[model samples]
Target: MKVAPAPSKAEVISLGCRLNISESEQIRALLADENNVVVINSCAVTSEAVRQTRQAIRRARRNRPDARLIVTGCAADIEREQLSAMQEVDGLIANTQKLDSRAWNVPASSRPVLAQHTRAFVTVQNGCDHACTFCIIPKGRGSSRSLTISEVLSDVEHHLSQGAAEVVLTGVDVTSWGHDLPGQPSLGQLVHAILERFPELSRLRMSSLDGVEIDTDLFDLFAGEERVMPHLHLSLQSGDDLILKRMKRRHSRKDAVDLVRRLRKYRPDLAIGADIIAGFPTETEDMHAQNKSIITELGIVHGHIFPYSPRPDTPAARMPQVDRAIIKQRAAELRAETQKCRDRWLINLIGTEQQVLAEKDGTGYAPSFARIQLPEGTPAGRILNVKPKKLEKGLLK
Candidate 1:
């Protein structure tokens, strides 16, 4: 019997969602070694996701031809056949189990996340059970599951020791968290545990949630836990009740409207964001206007506007498809409205102090939860006390 030391040269690539990024880290650990190696986390939510995944694969082949190419994530699940056909990939880990985190937290300079980025991601939950008509996540990522409260606390402690100043708790369906567990612990409780255990962390953030996720328990008391990021990414698939029913989404328009009202009522300065899908099948022009008006009324700080992409296996794929022209037209209109809302929020924050994690110097300033910029000399890594005094029209100036 021979004891193999394991492959020293390997890389892992992921495509789509923060959970995928977290999983790719796990894949790295699965193939890690005490030798020269490179690992790349990939994303494929949009064109950006595909580009990054391809770039990562290409970079590895160019730089480390000897390294084994391992591929995984939602993109792999969605396009497994296509990725499988790629000669570049040496091994494939499709929509399998979650990737462990020990793999890819390495530092370019022996420091995780390097000098500029202050916050690192910690996914407390994985998978989604929702059947939103347009989404294929449940097919790719499987069922709703979560790490225990003790497990999450331990990860935070490890990050704090590794010099992370902030942690963003992420998952596919974060609001659906804890339902799988026996006691059904709430996300708020997890937040409390993290803050209680490690007060050294400067900030904490949650991933997007549907309107059904927020209860009075969270919107009311979350502010008291000052470390929690005062931001929420709520989904408003459509503002029309008919579309809501047609799409089989969980809540009505009023539910989403009231959810924002609660967040604002609880924390007046809270930065609220939203995701609006335009041009689903059977979407009328009037229904589109209803969404635009609802968005205007909600006053969302930022909006991730997307036109419907009919995935192969989703229910919506069987329905009559909206013309690409109509979808594009509506998406352009929604995108303009989204930017207006974002601009208003940025301008409103012109002088308010906010905590920002500096991510490298780019066009002008540091970008954070808010599309805010601190002055030129503002340091990148540490949590900075920033009062955004000016808004550069396009990128943060």
Candidate 2:
């Protein structure tokens, strides 16, 4: 006799970026009661990312043969023709329509509930308008868009009510927020509105921002606001001016260094994070050296290093390509540099008191985003004041 299949449930496998993760949460809530549905919210940031997406699709299919496998997100849209041909996928949702109620065939009243997270991710912006030569995200995400101030306030309030101790404002180009809205208000004004409206929000953090786009209001908050966590992650793709120019980046190398220096003057404890690419097209040894040194120059304790991976239809891909081996080596070097800086920073934090928000993974994150190991069985989402006595394998204990 044939056995009956397991009960159907909705599962979203999200790949790439914090914004994708946040969007997946909304999709999860929308399909909470739906039957045998598995959604692969894919990524195509790099050729490797697309390969991983395909791998994820195949693995998901093998594991859940009876489930309805749907694909969405950047990969679904950007790599549309390729992914649609995969036998494992049943359908594809446009990246823009993935969040719409009608696309999911769910009721319009379905409320977004982030029950699994301790800190909520509130997306205030989406998409990018800039056309950096090396980037293909704009094509995948479409033009920039901003949620109105009122909508942002409602999002923040909802997360606060759900016991989220911290709320992160995330987007593809977060600093680009408010540019398309009425009067084209600066992101600073939007940030000010959120802080003013929600007095109960204990911690307000920002995701990656373009250094050049930071407005005066936002700068002042970073400098003076205690509730605003002392961390800034800049989208500084390269440190060599020539490489930056080739990438069509707005800021120069000095501009980033100067911004960090100025911010640190007012908020000495501010930690710097950056996204630095390695082995970009036409990069010389001096250029690679500049990329490595910027880590130290910016005091970048948190570094996201991406070895240059050419995406289809990008200008940089057409330029003289860097050897794959060299790219791999350079990426490793960047990681070592970042690790050295981070280890030293973590060591210095020993004996200092930190306000940590607990997570289910037996660890918590301090406001500086430092990982601190918690005592076993500590409740998730509990804010603990921890004076770490030692550092253990990259974790403060």
Highest TM-score against the true fold, candidate: 2
Candidate 1 Cα errors over 4 Å, as ranges: 1-14, 29-67, 98-117, 362-368, 375-378, 395-397
lDDT of 2 by residue, 1-397 (tens): 9999768789899999999989999888889878899999999988888999999999999998999999999999899999999999999999999999899898876356766578899999999999998888888899999999999998888888888888999999999998898899998898889889988887899999999999999999999999899989999999999999999999999999999999999998899999999999998889999999999898899899998999889999999999999999999999999999999999999999999999989999998899999889999989999999999888899
Off by over 4 Å in 2: 1-6
Candidate 1: residue 41 Cα off by (Å): 5.2
Judged by lDDT, which candidate is best? 2
**Candidate 1 C-alpha lDDT tens digits along 179-227:** 8998887777777778778767767777677768765556655545567
Q: Score candidate 1 by TM-score against the native.
A: 0.84
CA lDDT, every prediction? 0.69, 0.92
TM-scores of the candidates in the order shown: 0.84, 0.97
**Global lDDT for candidate 1?**
0.69
